[model samples]
Target: MRGIDVEVAPGEVFGFLGPNGAGKSSTMRMIACVSPRSEGTLQVLGMDPGVDGPRIRARIGVVPQQDNLDAELTVRQNLEIYGRYFGLSRAHVRAKAVELLEFAQLTERADDAVEPLSGGMKRRLTIARALVNDPELLLLDEPTTGLDPQARHLLWERLYRLKREGVTQIITTHYMDEAEQLCDRLVVMDGGVIVAEGSPAGLIERYSTREVLELRFTPESAPTAADLAHLAERVEQLPDRLLLYAADGEHVHREVARAGHRPLTALVRRSSLEDVFLRLTGRSLAE
Candidate 1:
């Protein structure tokens, strides 16, 4: 992927979406002031990152891709140690830890050691720890990568609440549904650059038809691209299926059936960001 260029408005949840090794983490690090950009202009909160790294960092909350919480300390102690690094007063740190524990739904486990926490619990604690200073902007990199479905939903609810409270968030994830549910706008980065950028709906509208018709057949009997020609505005052949992009999926399905070539299976559905990414990059969003 190429280096991306986009702006994230305050009080909005902006998602950075791409596959592994797509430079998503690289971009996040630069914005977090942990890694400096080699070229191009970069700014955060209207301040030049190169000139005011410390000041920019002070106002941002970062939940890195990896869990870096101190395993030797209890959940509450971890928050206290992080708060101390920000030069917060002892009284303030203690109060903030309690509030964060509650916010993370970890008040019951406040005194529990980090080593004993489940993956989901650890992730939530890490998020709470990041908020100890009440940052103006929050950055999350693949926040739910290793989480189960229930845990993912819980985290999403917490993030939604934060958004309602007017927190500006920058999230990076390979999960299509997560981006659709959480991002107000996003940029699709591939290689080292941005291939597409818009709201999830806008990207789908611009890159793909309103609906898609998927036709599956046995590998040996699959219809060739030429066979499905004229059935849709565009036809894409996949390993085991043919995608027909059209204005009306049901109508396209009828057309396909009328042609006397019966697919083993077929379905019509509304277009999604996954379709948009596949159309633009010629690969799945998670690939």
Candidate 2:
């Protein structure tokens, strides 16, 4: 919403990493050509979204945060009908639906009404429907929200396959692990602004230490950031735990013990995208 500038490569996965209400969805809508921006110029897939909205939309696919499939229609019928909107031949749509059913792993349930399918099945069908026209760019808004672990991983694998097959993808998500796992390059957006941008590992290396020591204490015995400042490069105090950022977590843990600060539980782990976000935004991504 505020002077946002980003360019996604032809075959790479680009991501918008942010918490709720950080303008991720609004930005996605503009890129999808569904919502026009009030200011500044915009280009998607080499065309201005305002002047060439229809042409841009014809070559792009969008999977919204919610599944909007017709419950009365069968899984295959859903894809066929969506393909028809793009003016594809009926023969092409039929064959494409068959291929997409296999890709979504719903071939056996192709004839079943969408209302009876599992949540994962519905999510996959939504994504398959988005691909019915063989879009050059795919925009997914929180593609795996509210799904079980198995379903989430299955979707991740499908996305990986798409990347391998040269489909350019833009994903918006609050899940730091998902962003780290799926994105080749990403921008960390906060309050309608890009706070940082880089590959996940690059951002981690730039913004966070190599390791983090997490110490959880009883409410009465918790140490303040100032109390642990000498033990690590940086100390962050949270309601549940204290994060000690350091190049070596074990060394910081040993120092904390030497300093006579005992915690209920201590964990030494590698830094993550979450840590990078916390460092950049001064709050957790879930916030």
Candidate 3:
């Protein structure tokens, strides 16, 4: 993660947005104190990670990209065991486990074995386990990568509650919608470097137009960018479509039809963080 600099404010949800191997995970590991930084200075919670790894870890929580619950244990036991690692009393951990089960909405599955639970339940358990110490800062790495839509929404609600209680979050994700919905401020990274940094609305306004008009044409009959050049401020021709970057999508679409460049389908929508990413990296976010 060379040439990368970041600062996260208290009680704010900060994000690292990029594709796979874009150094998002590497930066996250450094912040978590699980990996060492080879160069440059990094401080977390007003302490150097290398000098105070254990001290910093005790005051923070981490939710990894993958679920790593103990398969043989019951849902509630997982929380208890992790809490004891910090030298908390068994009685304290037991009560803490009860409270966390309720927090994660897993009170009914308290005794159920971990392996048979659904993906979302396990993820919630992992998060609940991380909060046993009630850390001040929370680190999440791709918190909702593989879950279904319903599961993703549920998790988002849980995270929102945490934010209301003033837990600072540092999240790494490749999902554009997730960053837009969750991050108060974020940085766009590609090739081990940060390309852009701002709020979602600010980034869109700075790097992209207010609206985009997407026209899909078949490969055999695809029109060149110049054919629609005069319709908008800029034109981008893709493998299956042409993007007209304009402030007013409705008017641009009307002008496109007037120019006799009919496409198979046309879609007019607001510009998104994906558009900003495409403008910076010359590739889709999914790439």
Residue 209, candidate 2: alpha-carbon lDDT: 92
**TM-scores for all candidates?**
0.95, 0.96, 0.96
Q: Candidate 2, which ten residues in sequence have the lowest lDDT sum?
A: 278-287
Question: How do the residues 66-108 of candidate 1 rate in per-residue lDDT, one tens digit apiece?
Answer: 9999999999999999999999999999999998998899999
Q: Cα deviation in Å at residue 32, candidate 2?
A: 0.4
Ordered from best to worst lDDT, the candidate numbers read 2, 3, 1
> For candidate 3, lDDT tens digit of each residue in 229-280?
9889889988778999999999999998887777899999999998997788
How far off is residue 170 in model 2, in Å? 0.3
Model 3 segments more than 4 A misplaced:
218-221, 284-287
Global lDDT of model 1? 0.90
Q: Lowest summed lDDT over 10 consecutive residues: which window, candidate 3?
A: 278-287
Range of the 10 consecutive residues with the lowest summed lDDT in candidate 1:
278-287
